[model samples]
Target: MILKDIRNIYHSELDALFGKEEVDSFFNVLIEHYLNLKRIHLVLDPQYMITKEEEQPLFEALTHLKSQKPIQYILGETEFYGLPFKVNEHTLIPRPETEELVDWIINCHTERSQIVSKEPQTKILDIGTGTGCIAISLAKHLLNTKVSALDVSEEALVIAQQNAELNVVNVEFIHDDILNSRQTELVSVFHKYDVIVSNPPYVRNLEKAEIQPNVLDNEPHLALFVDDENPLQFYKAICEFAQINLKANGMLYFEINEYLGAEMIALLEGYGFKNIELKKDLYGKDRMVKGVK
Candidate 1:
């Protein structure tokens, strides 16, 4: 079928499900993934024909899209921090706000390096590392940093390991539950890190209504949510761990639920973390928080 026809069908079927703008984005991404054609190629060659073999997968993808499956899951991969990451139902698809967290970390380290007049070989840890996006991105961008990532799910650790390798970054992947009492023992094997970061399960169960069906139905809830009664459970655990595991003057970073910025600041302060900063994402939501021990 011709590209224009495929585009029309995509819009007709998906516009209702995802809206016209998102459908256009889906079409562009799908065409690029399947045909290795850029968006310009579609516009320049409106009559570009897709082979029967290619059409089969495109049709399958459209069906999945119509069912409210995320396009990243349909594609089985996504780009984050300019690196390719393999994702599955076992892993949470990395989001753009998380990329802002990565950028913030990088910029902070870059500024520190300039002040020190040398790039210190900093050790960094990412707790609840799902898909290893944060760990790998920091490893890739901060060349002087050694990175380690931890996840409770073995399946998530497997995907995270694959993404680390895919990005050609050396991120240590650990498969231990952070909330377990055994965490201290597991963490002791490694030296204290200069930085510890987590984008852990912060979505309260009460916030489910705000989540889209594609995420609620298809994404892994293990990485997305906490009990409504204890929304900051993961944050508490990580901060406690950081007290012993992070070096003196070490930094802690978290991508948090926008509603809990005040609570997060209070929690960090209660933990004796200093120089706390709450940063807004591109959308101006209080999405990231940092503190120094």
Candidate 2:
């Protein structure tokens, strides 16, 4: 069958749900993933043909897309910070705003890579490291850094470990709930670190309406939400942990809820973290915050 007809079917079915531009992007990604053909190949060969067997995956993906499943999960892989990662239902898909947070960390530490310091090794930890995107991206870009990531879900950790291996970056994966303070072994893992970063569950239940169906329906809720009554529960725990675990002048970063930026600032200040910075993403939303210990 001519692939063009399949492309038309995609437009007719998905245009109302995802719009023309997004449908085009999805079709392009699907064709590349299933048919091993690029959009350029399609443009150059409008008559390109695929056997029935070659077309099955594309149709299956279309069915999933109709249900608002994320394309990245359907593909089982995504690119973050110019590196590839494996993603699934157990792991939240890495976001562009999180990429901004990773970029901030890399830029802040890029000088450390140049310094020939015989002092203690630079260590960094990522809490709630779904897909291990932040930890692995840092390990790939920053030199001479020991990176560790922790998550409550063993299934998410499995995917995170696979992503670490996929990206060829070394990351220590910990399977423990950050919110559980009673675990003795969990405390032992919090050695002094040069940096502690997190993009924890910051979304309040009230904000669910703001979330698109694609995410609210498909992504892991454990990684995406917190009780509206205690929206800052993860942040509070990480803050207290950083106060004890960070080295002198160590840095702490978080991707935060935009609506709670002022509250975040107050929370960090109350925890005695200094040099707090609330930065906006490309969308100009207060998306990330940083503090110094």
Candidate 3:
């Protein structure tokens, strides 16, 4: 089949499930992923033919898309902060907003290095490190940095470890349940970190209706949700852990739920975290919060 015919098929099959623009985007991504051809290439060669073998997987993907499977999961990988990561149902696909969170941390550390005469080797830890996107990105960008990541799910950690190797960064992966453990239980493994970050399960059960079908049906709920009664559960636990594990003047960063910014600030203050700051993502929703120990 020719490029134009395939494009039409994609739109006709997926337009109702996803919008027109998104369907177009998905077709473009599949074309690029399967054929190594860009959208402009398709436009330039509208008569470009795809073999039966090549068309089979694209059709399968269309069926998956019709069932509301996320394109990232369909592809089994994604790019985050300019680095590639392997993702599966075991891990939450990294989002653009989380990339902004990584950028904020990298920029902050870069500025701090400029102010100091010599940049000290920094130890960084990422909690609930699904896919190891934040930890690996920080390690990839920052110089003289030692990065470690922790997650309760061993399945998620396996994918995270693969991502770290794929990105050629050395990130220590630990299997620990942060919610069930005490500070003393972690002290032996986690001595001190100059920067601690987590993009934990901030989406509450009540927010299920707000989530897209692709995420609600396919993604790991353990990494995506919190109890509605106590929405700040992970944030509170991590903050308390940071109190004992973070070095003096260490930084804590979180990608948060937009609705609970005020509650996040209050929780941080209550935990004795200083210099708290809230930042919005590209869409202007309050998505990131930072505090200092």
Q: Model 2 segments beyond 4 Å from truth? A: 112-119, 184-190
lDDT of each: 0.91, 0.90, 0.91
lDDT for predicted candidate 1 compared with the true structure: 0.91
Please give, for residues 236-258, the per-residue lDDT of candidate 3 as tens digits. 88988888889999999999999
Residue 1, candidate 2: alpha-carbon lDDT: 89
Taking the tens digit of each residue's C-alpha lDDT, what string does model 2 give over 1-293? 89999999999999999899999999998888887788999889999899999889989999999999999999999999899999999999999999999999998877655564654568999999999999999999887789998899999999999888888889988888777776524544657889999999988999999999999999999889989899999999888888878888999999999999999999999999999999999999999999999
Give a tens-digit lDDT track for model 1, residues 1-293.
Answer: 89889889999988988799999899889888888889999778888898899898889999999899999999999999889999999999999999999999999998898888765689999999999999999999986888988888999999999888888889988888888857655775657899999999999998999999999999999999999999999899889899988999999999999999999999999999999999999999999999999
Candidate 1: which pairs clash?
none
TM-score of each: 0.95, 0.96, 0.95
